[model samples]
Target: MKVKLTIKLLISMIIVYYITMTVYVVLNLVIYNSNITFGEKVFSVSFNISKFMEPYIEDLEKGNDFSLDDNNINKLTQNNIWIQVLDKENKEVYEVNKPENIPNSYLTAELIEFIQDPWGSSAPTTISTNNIAKGNENYTLLIGFPIDKIFRFKMTLTDESFKYHISIIIFSLILMTIVAYIFSRNLVKPMVSVVEDIDDLKNGIYINKKNKQGIFKEVSKNINNLSLILKENELQRKEADKAKEEWIANISHDLKTPLSSIKGYAELLKGDQYEINIEEAKRYGTAILDNSNYIQELVNDLSLVYKLKNKVLPIKFKEENLINLLQESIIDLLNNSKYSNKEINFNYYDDNIILDCDKKYLKRAINNFIINSLEHNSKDTIVIVSVLKKENNINIIIEDNGYGIKEEDFKNIFTRYYRGVNTSSAYNGSGLGMAIAKEVIDCHDGVINIESEVGLGTKIIIVLKN
Candidate 1:
């Protein structure tokens, strides 16, 4: 996303320069160095003529009868070359009928021979050489040939090849510039669309449809994902607001019934026309007190649920024996007056399960499951709580023979303030019990699962890691 145009352009330019430089070097080497035989042919012909006249130098130095053959020498130096032979005294012993129009520099030269034969550029016909033979006396041989014209011809061809390579390099640079522009444009296009979407979002315009492709396809995908998340959150928020209003209405209705009954009975006692027994009066007062306490417990549970949802409550996790905790929680639940009349069956297996957990939070989670069962189950039905082992985890189950939840509502049963169809008629409790249980499980990085069939039974399973 942060890719800069200048960086892209720089890289493209470097590639173009490298390719052009490589092609230029290759063409130059091929035209000059690779053609070994071309330079050698000129050298070979010049060397042959010199080699053929080697015996004449010895003959003239020894004062033997020697012929100075100008016609043959003239024929040998036909190819734009000036040939000269010098004697032992450094005097010119032989000269070809060289062209007068030839440069004067070629005609006047002193020559010395190297022990190692000159190779490459130096071995060409431009070289001048002198050879000496030492025995009882010293004899010398010198020869010169001008080859500047051949060098000029080679340079001209090289210049032409370089000119062609320069033109190609210019065209290639232009092509690379075009390619870089297209590539950078394609890469940035999608991001531009995402930026525009952000501007729309800021102005309170939520566009959920994803309508972009190709170069900016990934950007579009990310935008679509963000849009979906926002939409889901908006829906949940609206649902929570509606639930809040319903909860207030339900709480008002519930409080009104108990308060109205207490008010009516108290008025009867205050009226002198009504004959009220003292025991009956006490019973009425106890009923009012019981309902008030229920309200208080309901309010307390609701408060805790809110804290858990907002992450205001902190959990203290530790390693403990889950079996002891489960048994203790059930005993505590049964001690309550509301659940004392309900038949409860406990099935515990020694699964050797030990887990790191917040003891109080997990106990609350289990208590929520028990309370849910008590609230929904039929009178005289037995509720079962069991513990078992799974792979590196402990599975605790609380089951009741109750009218089970609908299949459609299974996934969202643990959500906060989610009351089912029979909630208003069958139960009188805040809808945050299961939500609190879910929060506790999530804190332990565990999971909760439920299995149920309508009008048969409901099973709640909590899995915690060991």
Candidate 2:
């Protein structure tokens, strides 16, 4: 990017430089070859003073009157110029459109001084003098131009000096061009890098090239940070997509199993060839109902998780006794005959610790944690639930001395559809329990933290505002 931009800039500067040199050469030609100044070209005068007075100078040399025609007089007046003719005696022989301050007679010394320093005089006019002679009688013709219209400067230069000055000017211009090019290149270098980096980002390529020294240092740092964040997000999205695929497969299998059972039992009940008794029919009906309920529970979990994730789940916040809410969740779990043999303990000193929360979702989250402990461990494994008030916050801790979570699983514990590696085949689940619980806690503006070591135990802490 830098190379391309530098080349383009160098080309542009060269083009501009050459064009300027061309204009300079053309203007020099125009200035030296004509009496008309550059600014006067568009509105050129009919004739210049030197050309107009040339014919009359011959007449004055032959001893004729240095007089002008009406047309010449009008031309001189319009161009703001005056002419004076002086004869041998230093007396002004003829004058046209001359200023009042100009004396009709002059001493030779005065005439020489005025001619030498015309601009230094009070009149401050630019004067041009020409001498004409006939039969040893000499005459001078003087032309005076407005000071504002003409400027005169006298310069003395030899060939060598002129060449040396021209060489110096050319060298300085070259040096200036080189310096300007270098400065502009440096200025645009960082910008080129930035634009290229942005293009790479647009193509989903994230690179962290740190520019530590330059005006763009901060800009480079910010872009690199953004790249890192985007890279991380991209990785997360891929992981989520993989997990989603796994979840769909698992859900399909789970649904198929219950559906197959329900279908089988219904078929058995409907078979006329098999002479089924009322007791047998009742058993078949109960089996079918159980499978149906299981399917419905799975569906409900799926729906609830989607709502929670989308932040569309309505939460009815109200003050409730924390102790009672936890006890009720424990009792509900204990009421399940499958987990009745599980050893669970609830410990709390405060019975009236009040909290503002969505009772339904909060209770569901708590039940999920408790059930997770019960289902994942041996029946003899001890589980403890405790609630404590810390300053203005409430902490509910669930601990268990069970086969703790593996490190790999622990990292993604709350990720949707991520069942633990040690998940039991006997106890099937939708794999949305932990994810749902997390979402529920988040909706209540709460935090959940977990600490677990393999084979020792797992401790889960839920903190909520009081």
Candidate 3:
């Protein structure tokens, strides 16, 4: 039979107590059988009995008119005490019971030798005193107490006291047993419940918040925390799985679309036997080049996505004057022919802001934002770039007065491969630009957010710690 821990502990304690109590009782039995008790050792029997008969002993000692009364003699004999007196001739002068264990006459020297080795000759069952001399040496007194008789009397008194002592011991045992049971139950129950909860978790059964409290509350909290972490991981796993499938589908369609165009235009250019118009051939050549560049962009965006996500791409960080970095980025963007027809503006404070950032990655992110504005908006739109110190933070604000984004597409704007509903094909762009830009800013510990409304304008703001 499988025994529970509580039962086992309770049984073990009971057995221990039983063994202890048995040892106690057996030790007491051994002591009583040996005709010894703590009381006898502490106060000799003669002292006790002499106190009860003190007046009589004192009178005898003074040689006064003292003789054992019949009643007193009877009391002494009943209590196993025998008294005797002898003269110088060694003949008994007075005696009680005249115990047969000793001779009626004794030489003083012989009595002295006997006293030294009294128990040697399987001595009298009684404890005896050697001769005690009278002042004139005319008489000697002797007394004896029987060993068995003394133990009998001692047992009677002990039986009387055992009533209270035994009661207390028994009560203590019962109380201790109850306490042991309760302590064992309290200790084991919570652990058992926690183990059960852990088993449930192992079986994929979720434990509710309500289950996360007990005597072992810290263990419960850790288990609950494990559940929370697992739940989060499960959610992230599902998201990554969905994103993977979508990415594959999008990449396949996007790759084939440009490749099919390039192939068709190249075939058209290859068939020049019909004397194709020069302008028409040049147009086909342009189409092929555009498709090829778009394909290359797709490949590059995909590569950046994985590299940034894993943080394997190295970032070189350095302290830079924020104003100087912004001016440099603006100059590089102005040199681009794509934004030649677009209006650009810069506004900043005269006070320089110091920041730690990866200049290359930061410039790449800002370039994406500017390119997005130019490609997604109408020509001649005014794009404003501003830098301002907000408290302890630096704000790099990019605002474009251009055709704003549709509200529904805002949530997916930064998602990889998410091309908005109105994205243009003029730049042969991949939908990964904003996603890559967001990753770059995030890696730099910066914040980038966009605000826009349909037909109004779009604002892109980047906040950096100073």
Candidate 4:
């Protein structure tokens, strides 16, 4: 059977308490039977009895009569010990009710020996004696009890003590059980609550928050935090699904335009719709090739986006001159028929400084940046570029006085397929320019920063290794 943590803790604490009480009881019993116990009590009763014996001894030492205190005698005679008063010569002159097997009189040396090594197996563990003075005469007094009889007397009193002992045991059991219950409940309550909270999460239900204190406060707070994270993730998943649907629609639109052109041109070429010459044939052929190239370009862009996003593209790195690469990319873009009319200017201030670079990817990143500016801005827009060396870093800055990004869309400008509200269809294109640029720069262990104001302009900063 599966046991809950609370039950286990309760059982464990109860077992420990039981073991502790059992040990205490047994230890008390052992101490009662040991020689140390005998040594401790033997002198306690003897001192009281000595007070009664003082007068008896002083008179006896003078060969006169003496008396005893009956109450003191009774208190001192816990064990059935023989009590006696003797003269200096060790002759017994008086006797109290003593235990059997103890001799009436003793030679001083025999009594001394018995005191040193007590005599019988079931007798007093040892003897006790005291001296008295009477007119300068000396006397001795002795007492002995049976060890077996003393243990019997103790057992008799212990029988009576069981009434209170059993009461104490029952009382203690009740108290400890209550304490154990409270302790185990506190220890296990938080964990059990957490388990239930997890179950609620699995059921797609939010956990109800409650005020908790002590050690469980952190636990409750963490559970709430985890709930918030899962809730946010759930919301993000829904938004991503919606965004993906719109993105697929946009991609379909981009693909249809070129495909329609290709199909229409091929049909025209195959038809007898009009008379054709070399010039017309060449023009038709160029239009067909242009549409095909446009479709090919779209496919290539999608492929590169996926490869970079999934990290499936193999990239090779070699030491290349970044300053030269940037200048050439701009010059080549100016040479291209598409961006030929765009007024692009660049300022360079460095020689060939070598750095590890993947030529195709890095050049693509710079081209994407330059093209975004030229294509997005008007023909009158002036694009300025500068390459500067600062200690260990090479900084490439591109600035354009074009229609800038809106503040709301600035944060998401690099997210895939996220076209800003202010960006027109002519400028945003596929909405993958900045995202791809950022990813490529990141792959090179470099950084890209954009500073744009609503009506003024946009400036891009690319920092790379020198």
Best by lDDT: 2
lDDT of each: 0.68, 0.83, 0.74, 0.74
Per-residue lDDT tens digits for candidate 2, residues 157-273, read: 899989999999999988978976897699778888888888878899988886646888888888889889998999999999999899899889988898999999888887888
lDDT for each residue of candidate 3 in 1-466, tens digit (9 for 90 to 100): 1139789878988898789989999977676445455465423333344345464455466654337767767767666667777677876777776567677777878666544444543445444444444565656666666655443211444775888788998899889999999987877787777888788778876656655456689898888888778777777677657766776787787778888988887777787566778898888888888778778777777788889989887888899887888788888878766556568888987657888998888888888888888778777678899988987788888988888988656877787766665554344456788999999999888898789987888999998887
Residue range 1-466, candidate 4, lDDT tens digits: 1237878999999898779989988877665444343454553322344443465455445544644566546645664555676777777767776655556667767777667666432355545678766556666677555554332211444765988889998998889888888888887887677777778788777655784667878878887778878888888777667666777888788778777877887887898977778898888889888878877776787888999999986778899887788778988998888778788888876677667889889999889888777776667788998888888888889999988877756777777776555542354267777789888998888999899987788999999877
lDDT, model 4, position 295:
72
The C-alpha stretches of model 3 lying farther than 4 A from their native spots are 1-189, 203-207, 211-213, 271-278, 318-343, 349-357, 372-382, 389-393, 401-431, 443-445, 449-458
Candidate 4: residue 74 lDDT (0-100)? 66
Candidate 2 displacement at residue 430 in angstroms: 1.5
Q: Which candidate is the best by TM-score?
A: 2
Report the Cα lDDT for candidate 4.
Answer: 0.74
Error of 3 at 215 (Å): 1.4
Cα displacement (Å) at residue 156, model 1: 21
lDDT of 1 by residue, 199-294 (tens): 766665666866688866776777777777877877888877888788778778877877787788778778899778989889878877877787
Off by over 4 Å in 1: 1-195, 203-211, 259-276, 314-321, 335-337, 351-359, 423-426
TM-score of each: 0.56, 0.68, 0.56, 0.66
Q: How high is the lDDT of residue 210 in model 4? A: 83
Give residue 131's lDDT in candidate 2 (0 to 100). Answer: 87
- RMSD of each predicted structure: 13.0, 8.4, 13.3, 12.0
